[model samples]
Target: MGLSDSEILMPASGADAVRAFGDGRDVTVFAGGTILMPMIAYRRYPQRARTLMLGRAGLNQISADGNVAVGAMTTLAAIAGSGVEPLAAAARDVADPEIRAQATLGGNLCAPPSRQGPRGDLQAALLAARAEVRCAVAGRERIEPIDEFLAGLDAEPRLVLGVELERPRRAAYSSQRRPHAHSYAVMAVACAELADGVRVAAAGVAKRAVRLRSVERALADGAAAEQASAGALDGLEPQDDALASSWYRREVLPVLVRRAITQLGGG
Candidate 1:
């Protein structure tokens, strides 16, 4: 189906956007259109009742005062230079400059797993940072941790407003990817030293990014980076895809985790 067949709503403000996205039923939210445009061109996108365009929704600001706040519509290009550590690095590593300029943070966070491989490269960094997601759901605004948000993504329909988080004392990111920046990573890891302790997360090991709880426990118990990273595969099953086999992802994940943790001064 073509976009011309769908009812499109372009809201000028966040409030209007929320109202237009009521319950998200049969609605496809169009952000930067980095991913959706291709689907549309190839006729792979399903026909939805409505297309809610967020380009002018007044949701593209970044705040870095006492705490950090990023609007859902902020582009990866803007975030690549935001000095947000692993997030900026991950954003810079997304696609080429043109794709990054057109991809929005909200789209990245809500990206589903693709047949080729996992696609949300920024997810690991945001997971490690322990960001909070602000979304409009069920006719109300809700704030939840990133982990919780991801866990419930398939169960509910919502409009992502933005994300908020505190600055980390130290952060590091590591990944194994094809030479082409556009290709998704085989495995990626991100770590951050927060006031409470350290958090670690990885992507490409599953359908979505996941926290390395076993590794975090080992770190809290004073295990060396190498030793702590040995637990990277606990409670997780890697999948085979075009990029690499499950075994290869399993083998390399620990290495990436160790490298990120060591880089974060946890060695």
Candidate 2:
């Protein structure tokens, strides 16, 4: 079941891509290979029957006519320069320039947690932006809220096609990292003020980035930034990893949340 023995399927269009993905039984969808290649070299990657290379699937589009829509195949480098606020900043914070240019949005969304730490740096920002993920699952396409998509990620295998979201009136992002290209963030927070209300999310505190619903509710209840940030630990169960200890993540999450919220003028 090594890669050498696997069938490599490269689809030239989105339709054919999802059709190839079908039920995702023994398929590994390869995007930028930023996360996969390392595991591959270290011999830690799982063996699959097929590797679906999505390089030419015609999904690398970025649209901003009104509501923002970004194809899953779009590179982080493209997003960093797309003027998309917290997303742009989060994209810029990923790895070094070369990695950013090669790594992709879909790969980030679908990255499983590694032994070292959590992998999806863009999740918090996208969650706070109220992004919707458009993915092909079980032979059909569906769009769901970011949180819902993440909730079922471990239970299902889906092929991400793109993400769409309405721009927030104000947004901000904050993170603490070791100042290295390969270093994952110790903790990160993103906040946005949308037409409906405020949204907040955090990363590096769980298996995946999560929406800070308690914090958002507190904010809606007229709590100050500091008060709302106190709810950062509502449902999160932080775990110790190579980058930071559980206690450290618990202590600093509120600080990052407060900083991001305050930047959005939520104070």
Candidate 3:
């Protein structure tokens, strides 16, 4: 069917949104409309006949009580403006102000990346912070760790409700750009304090965001940030894209990783 034959649904609550998404037909959940709208208008999304818009489902909330809970509909502009650690810094580097205003956390996580590479700056920071993804399907809700969620990206549930991260003692994020007018990141790194020790994560360099377990272990064993970062890339594979080559990404990974650790007080 053509776009004109589509049915746009506006759900009033989370449950209603979940129900709409599980209606047994091709349904796309629309949040922020930053990615989906363009795809539909340009005929990129052929199955746009059923779309569930959750803009008014009361999911655009961010709370910081002990742990942080950010609704999926919360805009990147709001997150960047808050000055909240790692994530805030990551959000600041996203696109322009207009794009940020229409980009939501859930949409950013689930949307496919552009040719530049993985659009997972926030995912890296969240992984280091040990965040959780809250999702709902047919009103049945569940929370999964960020690692597990990323591991199962091929089978994500119907709707993303929110994301939760524990309060960290310290956190930092860093990314490299091509110095172009509005270039996306060539590579990005994030570090955060966890109960066990410091955790590290990276994006852009890989097809998917990933945790740097070797770096984290080396740092925990008292290795210098540079040394740990170097060791972390031993068996890793980085991607090559229009903005950067695999070799360039590999060379810059340690530098960005070192910077993130340094910003977190030599972690």
* Model 3 CA lDDT for position 236: 84
Per-residue error for 151 in candidate 1, Å, reads 1.1
Pairs in steric clash, model 1: none
Where's the lowest-lDDT run of ten residues in candidate 1? Answer: 38-47
Which residue runs does candidate 3 get wrong by more than 4 Å? 23-25, 46-48
Error of 3 at 203 (Å): 0.4
Instruction: Report lDDT (CA) for all predictions.
Output: 0.91, 0.91, 0.81
Report the number of backbone clashes for model 3.
Answer: 0
Question: Which is the winner by lDDT between candidate 2 and candidate 3?
Answer: 2
Model 3, span 1-267: residue lDDT tens: 777677989989877787788832477777888777778777787375687888988788899878888889889998898666778888888888988888898888776677556676588888888999998765678898988887776665447889998877888998997775256778888888977789899988677788899899899999887788876586688877887889998888989998888888865
* Cα lDDT of model 2 by residue, 231-250, tens digit: 99998889999899999999
Candidate 1 structure quality by residue, lDDT tens digits, 51-167: 999999989999988788999999999999999877898898887999999999999999888768898889999999999999998669999999999999989988999999998
**Candidate 3 or 1, higher TM-score:** 1
Model 3, global lDDT: 0.81
- Can you list the residue pairs that collide in candidate 3? none
Better of 1 and 3 by lDDT: 1
What does the lDDT read for residue 44 in candidate 2? Answer: 80
TM-score to native of every candidate shown: 0.97, 0.97, 0.93
